[model samples]
Target: MAHGDITHIDIPVGDTQAARTFYSGLFGWDIAEVPGFEGYPMWRAPNQISGGGLAPRDASFTTPRSYVEVDSIDDTLAQVSSLGGKVLMGKSQISPTSWWAIFEDLDGNQLGLYEGVTSAE
Candidate 1:
């Protein structure tokens, strides 16, 4: 996905398996646990272009979070801070070439930033 695109959406659920089953059955999404992400089951819409994960709900992540693809998490977080937002989570590695971070906007709405090296690149 290109920068600023809505890359992924995380649905916080009390039960991962139940959420997976409900979503897959309801939307006909293909849900499966990826190799490296065992407990987190990823789901892809029938369109194949839209996808997200069923994340275990927690105090910090009580709501669904939308991840926007970004060119640089560091730069984005800096901008966020300058614009009256707060970083909830600093940049963290997702893989050798990928990273993610979470930030809350001025209104306290949380959003995520994702930086990754795609195969197309």
Candidate 2:
């Protein structure tokens, strides 16, 4: 809330290989899949992660969304409706301490939310 630091960006494309090639050839950056994370490949930028990724249309994922990291996703979601935004997907756990959710603003701008920790009840 005090400072805005963009951790990374995620771009959605139909084909990962083609997208990777296009970006690599154009920007001279290496976008490769990390050995362990087979499917996920982070955009390798000179300074910060620029953005890259293929849409997992056929997978358990829905339409691609861009995630924004926040201190607490619950508070953000709470302010959604008041700010004329609607939650497309409720808070869900991605990992032991990571949470994500999809939402739509009044202008219909789709956004993804990410919280650092997933509280255990």
Candidate 3:
């Protein structure tokens, strides 16, 4: 992932299993339920390229969202606020070296920010 690059995407789905089957069967993607994620499934494209996840949609999250990689989640979020975007979700640690956050643009489109892996345990 590079700074300001679309690193991942999330597709909202009503049914995780159905989505998993449809995507995996249709595109030969490797979709599987990840533990500790409440059955949410992540997918890898057949060519082993782009990857994303299928998250159960709710009132707050009802559409597909693309995550843009950033060098610093905190700094990027500050910039987002300064630019008139609202932070829907604060920075959350996805792993020891990675973090993510969600925000809504001026037009109310949801987008995500991802801090790429770092040298951390």
TM-score of each: 0.94, 0.74, 0.89
Please rank every candidate by TM-score, starting with the best.
Answer: 1, 3, 2
* Tens-digit lDDT track of model 1 for 1-121: 8889998999999998889889988999999888788888888999998988999999878999999999999999999999999999999998888899999999999999999963322
Candidate 3 has which clashing residue pairs, if any?
none
The lDDT values for all models are 0.91, 0.68, 0.86
Per residue, candidate 3 scores C-alpha lDDT tens digits across 1-116 of 67989888899999888898899999899987666566777898976768889988998788889999998989999999999999999999987778899999999998999996
lDDT per residue for candidate 2 within 14-115, as digits (tens), equals 677887888888887768775544676656676544554444445535455667778778888998878889998999986677887878988877888877
Candidate 2 wrong stretches, greater than 4 Å? 1-4, 49-52, 57-64, 117-121
Best by lDDT: 1
Q: lDDT for model 1, on a 0 to 1 scale?
A: 0.91
Off by over 4 Å in 3: 118-121
Q: Could you list the CA RMSD of all candidates, in the order they appear?
A: 2.2, 4.9, 2.5
Number of clashing pairs per prediction, in order: 0, 0, 0
Model 2 poorest ten-residue lDDT run? 1-10
Give candidate 2's whole-model lDDT: 0.68
